[model samples]
Target: MASENQIVVLDGATARTGTGCMHGISWFVAKLGSTLAGLAADLDASLPSTLMTSIQAVADQHRATCDLLHPGTPSAVVALLRLNETVLEYLVLGDVTVIIDTADGLQVVADDRVDRTARAEREEADRYPFGSAEKQAALLRMKHAELAARNTPGGYWVAAADPTAARYAITGKIPLDTIRRVAVLTDGAARLVALFKLMDWPDVLELLDQHGPTELIRRVRAFEAADPSCMRWARNKRSDDATAVYAV
Candidate 1:
């Protein structure tokens, strides 16, 4: 949860193989979030510096625990925030989002480079029937291509085992007094506004204020359940893990 001082949210990379090191990814990300929050609170460090340090710490720990640390070795999206007396600082790495409600309007911050790369694959996969071998194969190819391009100049970046990816984070500062509320959400939960487009950001904030996070995610799940074949939602998976933190 975010308070007057800071916030952090993480979503583990989607894992395929049952034996992949991603089994420990949730643990790794939680630890990394703790490390990041502590640094921001204690040192009052710059956003980039805190992210860099946290990334290195988690990557080293992941390497020590897992025998192999390859591109597929489980990574997570990083969404962090620091609140100062007059402004709010943010660092967003990968697809997770930071949504802010300002006095003027709502602001959304996300990294869509990764999503853009996956779009082509999603289109191809969507051509095949659901639960078919062709669709599965197409999805596999897409994952491989995405893995190959990770951390590259033309490709997108994530908080994987590479500390260098930290430098690629999207960052900015917003005037504190201008903001009425903020929400940090994993992509899964963000689908309410981003992928599903069921409502705009303002509606989302209104829902959060009225019903809270659970009601928002409940609507998402209900929508997915209605379209089992994903003809309506058209996504890589029927559902992904959803998580969110709302602060006011």
Candidate 2:
């Protein structure tokens, strides 16, 4: 979602088989994204404050029909950039990446607490072959561990039923004059560097400069197709929802 002054990208979580929400992940992300964008447009609030209000608003819409406290309930990682006259205000929560091409160099803002949590279980899951029953069992254990850590102190935070998670988002301002370009990417699109080791951040920015955002995502899909079994680049899913927004 983008407008004259703001850009918003949301990566909705993959719905679990038994998510306690009455709505799907798509519904959650669509509502949350629109609400956040609307609030940001109408209110003179900070990025995090607008996000908090949006989450609370969405929760109010579904609270009576769904189990809001369930860990598996609908959630999303957020990447937001608001352009001001002299500065750019940005917010990142969960794994979404916001890359800034500035006069000094490239700056990346992302939250990695999810990777820091459930270490043992994730390692165990990695030990088993992908698509095997053993791997599935290990992944289940990892999921449970992740659920236990979600939104807790020292754990990762995402945009979910808890409005307070907005407080944990990475937020800051960068001088607008120093920025040459900006790219906001969901984790799926970032897998090119973060997971596949295909390129560095500079390389990614260069790619975006030369080819554009669609080509970046196309390359990611090509790589995933080449390694369909996850043998070369191990991952939880073969293909994820990839999205990218580039601004100059």
Which candidate number has the best TM-score? Answer: 2
lDDT per residue for candidate 2 within 1-248, as digits (tens), equals: 99999999999876534678888899999999999999988536899999999999999999999999887988899988998778899999999899999999899998888999999998888776677888788888888888788888989999999999999999999999999999988999999999998798889888998999999999999999998777688777788999989889
lDDT of 1 at 192: 79
Q: Candidate 2: lDDT of 215?
A: 98
Q: What is the lDDT of residue 113 in candidate 2?
A: 84
Q: Which stretches of candidate 2 lie above 4 Å from their native place?
A: none
lDDT of 1 at 221: 87
TM-score quality measure for candidate 1: 0.91
Which ranges of candidate 1 are over 4 A from the true structure?
A: 1-4, 17-23, 65-69
Cα lDDT of model 1 by residue, 11-113, tens digit: 8777653324644777767777787777878535778888788888876765655744565777788888888768988899999888998898888998988
TM-scores for every predicted model: 0.91, 0.96
